[model samples]
Target: MSERDAPDQGDAAGPPRQRPRSRAADWLRRRVGHRFPLVARLAWDDYRHEWLVSGFSVLALAAVLIPLLVLFGLKYGIITNLLDPLTENPRYREIAPITSGHYTPEWFASMSARSDVAFLVPRTRSLAASIKLLAPGSDVGRIIDVELIPSGDGDPALEAADDEDIGSPEGHGEVVLSASAAEKLGVGPGGRVEGVVTRTRQDRLETVRLPLAVAGVAPPTAFTRDGVFVSHDLLVAVEDFLDGRAVPELDWEGSAPRPADRAFAGFRMYARELGDVAGLRAELLRQNVDVRTSIADISLVQTLDRNLGIVYWIIAAISIVGYCMSFATSVWANVDRKRREFSVLRLTGFRTGDIVWFPILQAAFTALLAWLLAALVFFAVQGLLNALFAPTIGGGEPVARLRAWHLGAALLLTTAAAIAAALVGGRRVAQLEPSIGLRDN
Candidate 1:
């Protein structure tokens, strides 16, 4: 080929055509030319440039979150207060047999071995579980009959008693007195009392007086009426003596003591937690054992908690969906209006991935800022509500509250939702072509 004909190769393409750049590209180059990472700064600048729109988005999001926060705070506060007494105090977990039943040692062992059973002790019949107590140095005229409750290790009543470091009665000689019992005897902890047990055998009265030391005094919640918490052995001995069996332990005159496999009339039991009470009660009932418990009250509180939780979530779902849809639409429309600007960046060599981050960053910032605003507003409203309801809600408990975890969870959910909503606009940005800038201009 001739040299002139071969040289047409350079003229065929006519030196590379300069890529079209819009004013947005010139502005970006002037601001941050050849910067390693310009996506975040550009997004921020664009977000600031549209301050009015961004402000409205933030306020709209905050409006959605504030009411939800306040509603949830109220739910947590009111429900927690109602459930605290029943859950914290061990006394309310008590499960007592309605009528006497033959509960063997094996049965007691099985019941106590369960994970849900917090405490269990065998009890004697009502007739044999009474003791006439006389305070130390007092005459016989002051003797008062008090009900005896069998206690041992992990006794819920003793554990919940006001006295610290108080354990169950150690031996037959030691006993814990209920508030009424201690007051009636005019004694406190470390005091001594004379306990008298009587039996009518062979049409003759037999009386045995034993010295009892007071280990502690339980609060009124443990026992309302006059009662004494004694060792299981003492109650067994009293029952044996009343049954006319030889009481070698007490040295009371009677027949030979029965075998070691003797049955218990009933048992004192407690569940590990509020939820455990219902299942425990059901198990006992299935075994043909009738028992009394505060389950009705517990169930009422739990049901209220569950129902309120459902209602709260239902409302939250609706609000969250509405906010997300509205936010997505806003983000999408904003991207459509800024198509020419985004195309200018693309024409200037910014990749689709880089442009996609614009809306996402903006959305994340908006959500977080909204969350901050909502938190501030929620706390202010919480203080006002708490103060307004202080008189009705005793114990200085707040009427509206949110735990640390609750706020953290809310932040995570809202941030995630905002990002998801922005994805719609991000996809639109990704599809934009650099040629669109020229056509729009």
Candidate 2:
């Protein structure tokens, strides 16, 4: 500035020339428009490029996860097997009175209305509860005395063992025989039998015969003794005839007429579920009603379940914390290494929020892949353990088992932990300044 040297008007008066804006920013604004999709794509590409690091992270995660899965599988399988027998069979749910007590109709009604009470029926004394039975038209004098118990709809003892169409004795003339009784009387379903009640009055034996049709045969496990399940009405009639009370229903002749209000000697009660059995028994005892149940066995199974669950969860918590810290440390180091790259993005108009998502997305991918690997390993080990223990375990039951919901819960927990770990690394990324990129360059 002679022009240049002499009072350069242009340099003195003109606005200072602006440094050219970074083309990367211009391209980002024009083509990408938003930072999130670009951030996500970059995160995925970087994760794929660093295959060795990602693979190691996944392996580490799986190492912890596989053991936890296997442990839970064993716990679940064992506990489930233990509980199944008690739950599936109704016999274990029975609540039998220790001694005969006078239970009124009002008491039975209240018990029947309870949510926990599955079935409740009145019972007579053992002496009057017995009846003589013989198959009609049998050439052999095969008459057997059987215990008569009252049954109606939803009678647990009357439930069929197989897919056969067996039902409870609903009518006075219909009766269900126990396996022993059926065998002894040579009577099956659709066969006719005569039930006789004999009473001695004034040195004379009086006999009353009631014809019965066999309805069904209960399973051997339901009742081991030779017993007959009849309607409550029929049982009451037998009791009445034996008490020297007239049973007009069966045309039985006696001295005294039956009373209008009736009370029972005892009852046959069953709980709706195994868990309810203890509560039902406790309530009865509180009311001065003594009863018996398989509470010791039930309590043992429940204790095992609780103890195993506690052990599993404790191990799981420790492993989860350890793995998460390890994962977070790895992610934080990766972020420190990529400070310049993140700074470049910031300088090119990317927001702190967008850049923070980079590590998080990578963590998610790592967690998902790790879960897949762990599941595969768990199933393999499960198969081997089950096969090895098959002969000893009995019933071809597996020693290890996992359900669909279990796998789903595991996946969710793993992902949540991974995201939590990535959040730590994200905090480090948020503190990065754009000038770091210029100094590095």
Candidate 3:
């Protein structure tokens, strides 16, 4: 037959079909629609027949994940408990003067005017800060030297008191003892004590005794050392006596003392919030004033939290690598055992990609079961640890807890690792030749 006139073999068969533009998408959809149910059924059959090996894979994953979750929970709980009080208490956020300076009244006024300054109190001279306390009209009198710190309105360290309790003695006569100081002096609220303040004047040290009333006792946590809190007015009185100047309220007769200046050694300042502490300190430093705050401790705690998070990620990575290796090995062995089945499926017109889904689905199911078991194990361990160690380590709080995000992350990581491992095994299964089934048949 002439080439053009002869019966065309292509025409006799049929017209050539054109492939779709999105060949990959059409192929994937066709394979998934035809084989997903078959893959699911095969996976279920494998799981039921190979229950022992499947359980082992789940247990293996749980072994690594459970301990990681527990350690993370414990560290989070312990650190939070240790830092809660320091971070929550406004008193600990105080900025105290580190060096003595002439803090004039104008300087204090300006500082107090700043929006960041919540409270401002001046400190007395250290040398002049010491005072001798004696209980009045009792053998309970014990000569004790105490530091006198400045306290006034809005002092967070001082407990709330009535107007009478906080009333000024008009001199060095009203004082609030710290809990430790009060215990040592055998005094409480509404008690009377005498103070013998000594100062140097005209190159001679002189003693001036004055009467004081104990208005209240501050809590033990208020101060790190034994001391007494007095209003700024009382502090001025104590300073006058230490300078050997006559204080009329104490009934001392001497040359009229020079008018007290507005200058102070330093001032104690409080920021409006913890977040403002660093800014306040920086501003004070720029003004050439030395300041101190608990910001250093807060920074340290935050750094530790960040480091722990890094450690957690490192641990998770290691665990995921280990689990992937384990899951891949198990799936590979199972595929090797079922090579003939995959060969038969391919011979029956199943595509390599469709056959691959069998093992992938099985791996996914295994990961799901493992994650469930791991969650159960985590909760059990959390309860056990909280019961065993909460009192000593967390002050009766839970020592371990799994936050929702943690659980979600764990599940996602495990499932992704399982799918990846299964894909690796699926590549091996896809390489099997359909001829193997025919030969075996």
RMSD of each: 9.0, 9.5, 12.2
* Candidate 3 local distance difference test against the native: 0.77
lDDT of each: 0.88, 0.88, 0.77
Candidate 1 least-lDDT 10 residues: 6-15
In candidate 1, stretches whose alpha carbon ends up further than 4 angstroms from where it belongs are: 1-51, 137-141, 161-165, 202-204, 247-253, 340-355, 393-396, 433-441
lDDT of 1 by residue, 252-339 (tens): 8788898989998998999999899999999999999999999999999999999999999999999999999999999999999999
- Give stretches of model 2 more than 4 Å off: 1-42, 137-141, 161-165, 255-261, 344-350, 433-440
Candidate 3 structure quality by residue, lDDT tens digits, 96-184:
87889888878888888988888888886898777887787656668888888887777767643322333322345678887888887
**Top-scoring candidate (TM-score):** 2
How many times do residue backbones clash in model 1?
1
Candidate 1 global Cα RMSD: 9.0
**Model 1 lDDT vs. the true structure?**
0.88
- Candidate 2 lDDT over 1-441, as tens digits, reads 233444411334344685465778667656755466568889999999999988999999999999999999999988888888887677899999989899988999999999999999999988999999999765555889999989988898777666565788866799999999888887788988999889987778999888899998988877899899999889888888888888787777887766756888899999998889999999999999999899898999999999999999999999999999999999999999999999999898678988999989999999999999999999999999989985588357887999999999999999999999999999999999998989987
Which parts of model 3 have CA positions greater than 4 angstroms off? 1-76, 88-91, 159-172, 200-206, 246-261, 272-274, 306-382, 388-397, 401-441
Residue 364 in candidate 1 has what lDDT? Answer: 90
